[model samples]
Target: MVQFSFFVLPLCFLFNSRKIDNENIKTLQNDSFMRYINLESLYLEDNKLTTIHPGTFSGLGNVHWLGLMGNRLQTLDGGGICHDAPSIRWLSLGNNKISTIEPHAFDCLSQLSDLNISLNPLQSMDEDVFEGLDRIKSLYVYTIYYTDFSTAMFDNTTNLDHVYFSKFRYCNFALHVRHCEPNSDGISSLEHLLARGVLRVCVWVIAVLTCTGNTCVMIGRSLMKHENKVHSLFIKNLCASDLVMGVYLIIIGTKDVVYRGIYNRHALEWKESFGCQFTGFLAMLSSEVSVLLLTYMSVERFLCVVFPYRDRRPNVRQAAVVLIAIWLTGFFLAFSPLIGHGLGYFDSFYGNNGVCFPLHLHQPYLRGWEYSAFIFLGVNFTSLLIILSAYTGMFISIQRTRRSIASSFTTYVGQATNGWIPDIQRKNLRTTALSGSMYAWIVIFILPINSAINPILYSLTTRTF
Candidate 1:
């Protein structure tokens, strides 16, 4: 068969004596390049090509580089493109939809020096994927978070001089390999999860404040008499929710101490452990329940302020039922990823990052992105809208009441200003960095501070402080 008898659409560019460049090429039939025997490099980058039939490059024995980045290829079975390409040194399949690479996929590329499989949504890598590539020096893979490598995945490639991954924990697997892309995962450096002294100090401080402040609020609210005793129960429950967050923070902080300088050695194990997952569950439950409780509190305040004559406050029994339902809903939201979820749940939804929270905004193609999106963009987003609507209505009501009853703006602004002006201002701490290492700090720092502030914000008008 004439190998180039038919040309691939989008006109593949064959470069100076040694290469073929396919610009937006769509497909490559078997034996497509049988005549390109002397070609040294092939660039099919950023193309719409989906599959590269095995034996497609059967006769290209001298080819050195193959660029398959930004394509739709999903899996690599054994010895596909790398077949017959013994001298191939650099091969990139980055930004593809790859999920699986069968054993000995690179079995023939013995002289391959640099292999890039980065940005591929790899599900799992078999221990023998790189079985025969003992001479390879650099591995440009990962930034794909959910994928777990078999402990022996690098047993053959132990001489790796350069390695890159989404987690610093991965370094432990490639032991003798000295140079690793990320020395630290921001919240955690090679030395500690709370890498910065400031972060370490902040963790303990916020945990103490959150636990202490919420405890004080609960005790004070119970001891003092309020017009709405049922409402007081709701406040007590909110404190309990915040207290869980405090406990979660303390656990993280304590582990930061226990594992102090050897975080890298234990990073992977810690994230995969049951203790981490439970704290994650604790965090999700506390976060969702707290959101619901705040929405409830805001809705009640909106009603009382906007319609002074209407009796909308729930009785003790009603409040109890509502609180129970809220906690139950939170449990459902938090535990949904762990129970009866489809195969994706097997990946350990919360276990991807060190903190055990499944917020993978920074990690590429992480498993459970659908569920996380549903929670962040679906449930939590809806809750945010409700809370905003309640607060906005309450603010509008204050304006109207002021117009009618001549109440001054000073009264409300003064309260907010007074609550905010002393000793602290909330920092948004959002990051623009694409690395999961950088973004994990937002979760580690911001959420705990919010928990610490909740009781203080709630008790601003009271003598509890």
Candidate 2:
């Protein structure tokens, strides 16, 4: 159903003109341009061309530029390209329903310098999909697909120097590509993830202090003779949990350094990597175990102060069992996402962010929201309540342990369980929700401080009086 007035076609072709566009061109028949030998450019934009049969462009001589944008082109197959036009350098096939590009579709157009394949529904592409385009230099890609594109998609395009991708994540695979546009995603840049110099320094400082403080506490506990061995054991385990937090921070800081400058290039790969998953697991394990350990200690202190006459404290063997159980529980909770991922419960739960921290504050209802909600609202909220009650009861009796209670309360509250409530999970619920500010503050100061403050809060080597 191709319609075009042949009245002025020969006159325009005689003058070596460039436009056959803005017409109701539904299709092109074989040897459509056989007589137009002088035509150097052809623009068939905004047409209803559904398909092009073999030999449609067979005799297009000297045509170097072809613009087929804003068409109903579904597939790029045989006979669409000029049969003998080796001079065709610029080809614009954008804004079409192009989901497939048949083999050798562009084999004849070896001199094509720029290819605009943007705004198409091509969900995935094979590694060697652009096999014949040896001289392709610039590729424009902007798709609605979320698939992980293969890194070797442009390996055969050896001359390709300029790549324009809509998503920053795709920049990683375009190796040897000289120029890639839109490299920054606001929070992450080539220089750093935090985007601010102060936060970058703070991450390293927190990591060092957290590890140093916990290590000192552990060393002092082992060397000094504490009157209560069970108390010493509890303190040792708490320090170990905090040490894990420090390790998590150290890993995060290292990753930021390793990926600085070219952050977007490796952003997606790093986020979906095993290292990120493990780091996030470490964060969860450390944070939860630390909270639980503090709760246990608070209750132990509460029993000693309020019911001082009663022998409610568990023996060393029972305490050992409790520590083992607490660790196992933390491990299970942290590792649950990995297991649930296999069962289709999550997709890269731990690898959701650049820092590998699964805060989900940006979009709380995003993928795996239920699992995160359970961890934050169900487990963490309950632990906070237990710790608060234990400290409150103990403070009423002795009034001396108020200092320890306040520090522990502040530490647990800093985890930000208030943001996890399902009722207000939406960021718009309050008009301003914590995004990177909460993540930055927690990672730099609050989260690491859990282990950093243990040595100060509960001095195991010293008398508990």
Candidate 3:
């Protein structure tokens, strides 16, 4: 069979380029588009033009706003036909090299409502510079060279309502504050830099080691054979939980190392992003799962030690069900914040550190602290007690049995039939001792090792960097 192929071309829509502001025009006089009578706004900012002809703007009969900001204009001459242009409502001359504006520079801008002449070298403003602007409502004179302007500057226009003088450098001798927000956090950039750098490096190192070591343990367990498959299954489950914790640590470390502090490094929009919240959720989920799994493992080993001959060991299917339950319970614990467990629990910008940390550690967390205390005492503390007491009891029971057997053996040293214990009984005792010791090592070291390194993990998780 032969197949036919057809090609289709997508339709494209075009727009008028003249309607867009042209930033490449260096001189307004040389731009032919200035005569486009339909143009309503002209932006000639960030250019190299040094002079404005009185007739330069006359062709823009319908232009209602003009921007001449960031230009090299040194003076505004009366020859400009800006006075003859149509009703222009706004004009900007900010960030210019202009040092003077002729007496009647804006005498004909009767309809102008907003005037921006900021960042100029005008040492003083004569009332005549704004004589004809009667409808002006907003004036921006920020960062001007004048120490003080004439008091009558606004007397000619009574409609002025908003005047911005932010960073009025000439007014430093007076009691005026120019900028306030950037320094609101109070920590100097140098101090913040040092703090963030040290923290990021530490977190990165911990994350890499934890992730690598736990991954190796998990993979090793998967490939290795176990004499007791049931116990091996539980060990694998525990390692899986640790793997999640390692992944969580890696995410936190990368976020801090790449983003640094939110105060200076990230934009304001970062607070609305999901990066921080997702990292926090993973961290919480992994942490809760690790603890819950450890508790479950301890209980399972405790049962095995306490009931050696009952054949109570769980099968593979039963272990799977139990592991699922453990995971679900961990999910519930980590998701408490979504139900309003504490205010700002999921907000990354709530505290001084600007991170999504536990509410119990932030300010005004009296109730949160109380809740955390209850959980610590009831869950973590109970688990610790069970693990310690169970292992101690197992060892004690073994020691007592050893003593009783030794006494029996001594009493029946010469009796031919009395010294004979079944080979099965000896094997059972040996198996029990080995199993107990294995569990004791895991309970005493494996679980606590993860818990002991928690401070390092949490230090990075709670901080913004």
Q: What lDDT does each candidate get?
A: 0.70, 0.71, 0.50
Compose the digit string of candidate 3's lDDT tens values, residues 254-313.
544454443333423332345544554555566556656655655564455556567767
- Candidate 2 local lDDT, 1-465, one digit each (tens): 655534335544475656766687886766667777877888889888888777666667688888889898888764567455656888888898888776667777778889888888875566666677788898888753535466767778888888888655466667567777545433455446666677678778878877888788889889998787887888889889989988988888888888777676677678877888889899989878877776777677668667778956788899999999999999998988877664545666887666666656554654686777677667776776786787666556665645574445444433323323332343224244455555566556655655665666555323543
Model 1 lDDT-worst window of ten: 420-429
TM-score of each: 0.72, 0.70, 0.43
> For model 3, which pairs clash?
54-79, 54-80, 54-81, 256-465
Error of 2 at 327 (Å): 2.2
How many residue pairs clash (N, CA or C atoms closer than 3 angstroms) in each of the candidate models, in the order given? 0, 1, 4
| Candidate 3 wrong stretches, greater than 4 Å | 1-197, 265-272, 339-355, 362-371, 400-465
Pairs that clash in candidate 2: 190-261
State how far residue 448 of model 1 sits from its true place (Å): 2.1
Q: Report the C-alpha lDDT of model 1 over 102-125, residue by residue, as the tens digit.
A: 777889788888989889888867
